[model samples]
Target: MKLLIVTPHFYPENFKVNDMAFELQKRGHDVSVMTAIPDYPEGRFYKGYGIFKKRRESINGVKVHRSLIIPRHSGSSFWLAMNYLSYTFFASLKSLWFGIAKKYDAIIVHEPSPILVGIPAVIIKKLQKIPVHFWVLDLWPESLTAAGGITNKNIIYPFEKLTKWIYDNCTTLMIGSKGYEKSICNKGDFKDKIEFFPNWVEDSLESQKMIDVPKLPKGFNVVIAGNMGDAQDLPHIMETARMLKGSNIRFNFIGDGRKREYVENYARENGLMNNIFCLGRYPLEAMPAFFAQADILFMALKDTPIFALTVPSRLQAYMSSGKPVVAMINGEGADTIREADCGWSVPAGDSEQLANLLKHLSTLNKDELTQKGANGKEYSRKYYDFTKCINHLEKIIGTGL
Candidate 1:
């Protein structure tokens, strides 16, 4: 089977879709993914790549076609919209012209935001008579509004209509959480086509089995890793760090995004320099060792209704690393941790509540923490491993073909 994957984020961008495509290829399917050059979240081009014109290459045996795009930082909504639109246009044109000869059996379009890439997949699927699957990373318009990225009355209606159109047209739509299905199905009026497909943790490929955990800071380490954007409400975490000062616990934020400067500023103002450490963005490959080094893993999100239906990808990674999580988040993400017995969750944005929860963590014995971590690791291996997740995806692709 020939599989064509259309996503704005792919190889060299530290997105999971890269490993996904590789898994598909290893399964004996001919898989090729088309994407823009490796500029994401920051909108800056990677060190060696250029924008404008398509570049073709292969990474670890998977065929890749990189199209030109107007890169913009994730925090800047206007430029980000332009960036997605430009990639949507050029990738569609270039793929149709240069890639049609391969005759794809099925097309998978990853929907991170805006449905830009999915629109192109819809066109190609309609013209070529191939089945198209739209994978929802996050529910769009709603998520955009939740993140305060865009709320203009003039554009909201059109964007919502476009989202409904894409959902209506795709042969199948895969959402990352069960909590998201109802919202998407309601919007698209296509309940039969929507499938619950949570993001999985491919631990062996993405993380190293700890021979031994690395040396921690002077106190117990509570590490939060991944993007520091508005959606995460990192300020609350900073406040929690301040509250933990002089205690036997410290906070380390090991990722970067729009809120990086804000977090740094807050740490400085609160005199948390010794208690909180900000490690800039590290590549996806280097994350596992860092995860192993932590005494507790942290996850949080802004207080928004839409977030109730969302789960951040980092949760899977954190759980798979055999670390107990402290989730100051809402809804599906919180539910997952609760169900797995892997962590504790407090309401979003309440630093006092989060701080108290952190304090409770301090009371847990090493054996209890290890038990929770082990439970999470076991659950991830059995239910949320990429091997299992992608196998389900492959079956869907095969059925479509």
Candidate 2:
């Protein structure tokens, strides 16, 4: 089958879907990607690429069409919206102008918001008479609501109406967690279309056997590696660090985001210098070593009403590493931790609760720790494997075809 995968984020941009696209190609599908030039949270074109009209190229065997974007939105909300809108605009135009006529079995769009690419996607689906499936990585409007950024209910009605339109139109809706399925369906439509599309990590046994990886700085290391943003209560993490200041426990933050400066300054000012270590973002490929070396992994989102439905992508990575998590969030994340018996899930934003969990984890014997980590790995292998999700994708495409 021939497929066109549309996303604003793709190769050389450190997104997981790039690997998934390659996997699709390897499965004997002719896969091509339509994307913007690599500029994400940083808003700067990558070193070799210029900002301009669309450029076409091949990476490995997959064909790619890269379009130009505004290229100036890293942290600011207004610019970030502009950045998203810019890619969506150009990618949609390019898709209509170029991709609409192409013969393909299906169109798979990646999303937090695939709305920009959706225009051409819908166009091609209409013109070519093929199915277009929107693969949702994050639930929209709800996530916006979860962040507490959108308070205007007056505007929400129109946006909600549009969201319903998109939801009903897409041939199939794919998401990462079952929790999301319920939330999306509760909107009164789209109940039947939502399906779990678990994210995957490639086999790590080879690398684990290959060499002795670098160890962490020292002591009981708990690491949080991913976006540090408004959705994630990183300030609470600093507060937790402050509470653990004199302990042997160390909290390592490895990722970049809009809130990096704020999180950094809080630690410095609060004198959490002894407990918290902020390492700037590392390349995606380099993340495994850090995960492998950590004593326990961690995830935290703000105490929001909607986050009760979010199961962060970081949890998948943490599960794959065979390490128990020290989670500081609620709802879906806590449920996962409980169901898998993989780690402890403490209340969000409570430094006292977090401090206790951290100290308790330190007291656990190696064998107990290993068992918990193994439980997480087992749960991930059974329920969150990408291969199974890809099979599910193939089935959905088959139904549509």
Candidate 3:
């Protein structure tokens, strides 16, 4: 099958879409990507890319067509909206041109966020007369408010209408969490279209180099290794660290985000320097070793109604790394951790419960901890392997998942 994946982020941007494209290509499908210029996280063009440079490229034999994208200089809602709108406009225009020139069996729109990408995907679907598989990685409107990106309810109705319009057009709508099902099913006639398609760990996860962490303290390290942004609810995690002060457990935060300084400052001001170590950042390749060294992997999110229906990608990565997790997140993601018997979970923002869970996990012997990690690894392999994920995609391409 000739498949074109439409997304705002793609290869060289460090997203699961890169691996998904690779897996599709590995399966002998002709996979081409249509995405924006790489400007992410730091919100600047990457070293070699500019607004005008390198518009076309190929990765691992797969062709990538990059559309015009404006770098996000600030987190202002207006700029962010322009970023999404301009990317959607240009990507759709370019894709329509590409659609007229080339034919495809299916089109997969990797909707990680900024729901407007569907506008182009829908246009191309109608023009090309092929299946449009909308892979919704995040829920809109709700997510915008939940992530603190946009909070004005008066402005949310348009997004809600747009979200339903996009869903109504797609041949297959795939969601990463079952928690999303109830919300999406409430939309018009979507019951038969929506399917559960969980995210998967990278195929190269085992190849991550074993880097040493010389500064890491020698105790049970509860490692939280991802973006420390607004959604992480880091204040609660810091409070948990403060509560666990004087204990042997060390909280290692190993990522960069908007709230990194806040977390670091809180740790310092409260004399939690020893209890919580704010290690800045690590390359993706270095993550496996960090997880390997951790006695328990830690994850958190703000307690929001929308977040309860979401699962952070790190859950799959933690499980794949064969590490037990202590997840202080909301609903389905927490339920998954418990169901896998991987580790414990506490309600988001509940410092006391998180602290207690940590103490309970600390009481368990190393062998018991290893068993939990092993269970998580086996569970990830059985349920969330990329091979299985793409095979499901194949079935969906043939019919629908």
Most accurate candidate by lDDT: 3
lDDT of 2 by residue, 1-401 (tens): 89988888887886767877887888888999988888766668877776643378788788998876777566576776677778778876777775545788899988865344566677667778778888877666676676637778885676666667666668888887677787678665787787667667655521364343345677899988988788889878877788788889988888888888888788788887768787877766567778777899999988986777778778877887788888888888889889999988988878789988888889889888888899998988898777776777788878322
Candidate 2, residue 193: Cα displacement in angstroms equals 1.9
TM-score of each: 0.93, 0.93, 0.94
Off by over 4 Å in 1: 52-54, 95-102, 205-215, 399-401
lDDT of 1 by residue, 131-198 (tens): 88888887767866887566787767777888888887788888888888788877857888887788
lDDT of 2 at 102: 73
The Cα local distance difference test for each model comes to 0.80, 0.77, 0.85
lDDT of 3 by residue, 188-286 (tens): 779899878989888655555686664578887988888877888998998988998889899998887778888889988998888888887777888
> In model 1, how large is the Cα lDDT of residue 69?
84
What total of clashing residue pairs does each candidate reach?
0, 0, 0
Ranking by TM-score: 3, 1, 2
Better of 1 and 2 by lDDT: 1
